[model samples]
Target: MRINMKPEEAKDILSDMRDQHLCFLESSENKDEWKKKYLKEAWACDSGAKALEKQIPCKPEEYVPDFPYNIFSTQKCAKCGTPVIGKKISKYCSECGQKIDWGEE
Candidate 1:
């Protein structure tokens, strides 16, 4: 699929991506507050990324899941049985460093 957008459009997307990536990378010294703040910032960045995509004027060939899909609902680590927090694409257990099987990709 080839789509030629205006240079300004491309620059907008690049700028958005860079900003979001920076937000994701920023960290705090406080562990508890860091996690909470990180998740909030990540969600904001994700929303911004989606908005940027929507402005691209192209049709998506696949689905994009909504952010914060039931924070209470979680998947268990296949090896250690510890609940996998946050991301569904997590391939490693943060607690035990064991490989996680999240079923079919």
Candidate 2:
């Protein structure tokens, strides 16, 4: 079924569900094979949701760290202050699911 909701809201809901499933898996003593399988499937769905959450495009802002050397420069998400690491930042921010635009060097 189709659901109408903002990307942030949907991501929060999915994150909550994933956290709940993790709590269940950790706290429950039920070693039942069926339940374990079910949780595994839910985990897979959550993984997919993570990719889907990167719907908001945001450009990364370059910054220089306090380190003595300027080589310590890096980029952070403009929307969320999450650091983006790598020779080239990925298409989306891993922390807040903001689509990243590295722009032209």
Candidate 3:
């Protein structure tokens, strides 16, 4: 039988099933055997989800704003008092054609 479910829903269902199975195994006398078998299956499901997760490419770092920066250079324009410097600033100000000098102080 074919089951139609969204990826997220499928994952949630699988996780719930895994939790339920684990609880059942823990309560039963044959806990060790069930635990091993259930864990193996759960691991397989987790690996499958991981593989699927990798298939969906996330946005590139450059495309995302507010990305973390190690060395942040906060410099104001000597003439205009505009904050300019770092990876976000590719060129001189769009407002003024004046060159921005991030002095190394």
Candidate 4:
């Protein structure tokens, strides 16, 4: 099953897991073997968190009128410029996974 989470929340979870593994590694009696395993996992978590931290905040650009009646409009992700052709919009860009804030519009 897929789980969705805010970038900050995911980062915090990964950072916490990395810390716990580091603590385990520090106190482990079998340093050689445990170090290899825990260190790899910790590194993975650290990188994942770092990647989330680096994502730029963005929103949907102003919708351009599509039909002559102006009932329909085409919107694009500000970061990725992936066009979204409809009135219904999502909180995140489907193409690039960039967070989108269509605030008060």
Candidate 4 lDDT, tens digit per residue, 1-105? 999888889989999999999998888476598899999999999999877864635657876655578565678888778876664457667787776666655
Model 3, C-alpha of 16: deviation from truth (Å): 2.4
TM-score for predicted model 3 compared with the true structure = 0.41
User: Any runs in candidate 4 off by more than 4 Å, and if so which?
Assistant: 56-105
List lDDT for all candidates, in order.
0.54, 0.72, 0.52, 0.78
Ranking of all candidate structures by their lDDT, best first = 4, 2, 1, 3
Over 59-82, each residue of candidate 2 has an lDDT whose tens digit, in order, gives: 788755666765645788787888
lDDT of 3 by residue, 1-105 (tens): 998876556666666765776676676577577778877877776665554443332221222225576365554444444555564353454443444333331
Task: List candidate 3 stretches off by more than 4 Å.
Answer: 1-4, 63-105
lDDT of 1 at 10: 62
What's the lDDT of the predicted structure labeled candidate 3? 0.52
Which model, 2 or 4, shows the larger TM-score? Answer: 4
Q: Candidate 1 residues 1-105, lDDT tens each?
A: 999876447656665765765565565554776667666666675665544443332211222335656544565654445666554555666665555444455
Q: Kindly report which residue stretches of model 1 are placed more than 4 angstroms away from their true locations once superposed.
A: 1-30, 59-105
TM-score of each: 0.31, 0.49, 0.41, 0.51
Clashing pairs in 2: none
Q: Return the TM-score for candidate 4, rounded to 2 decimals.
A: 0.51
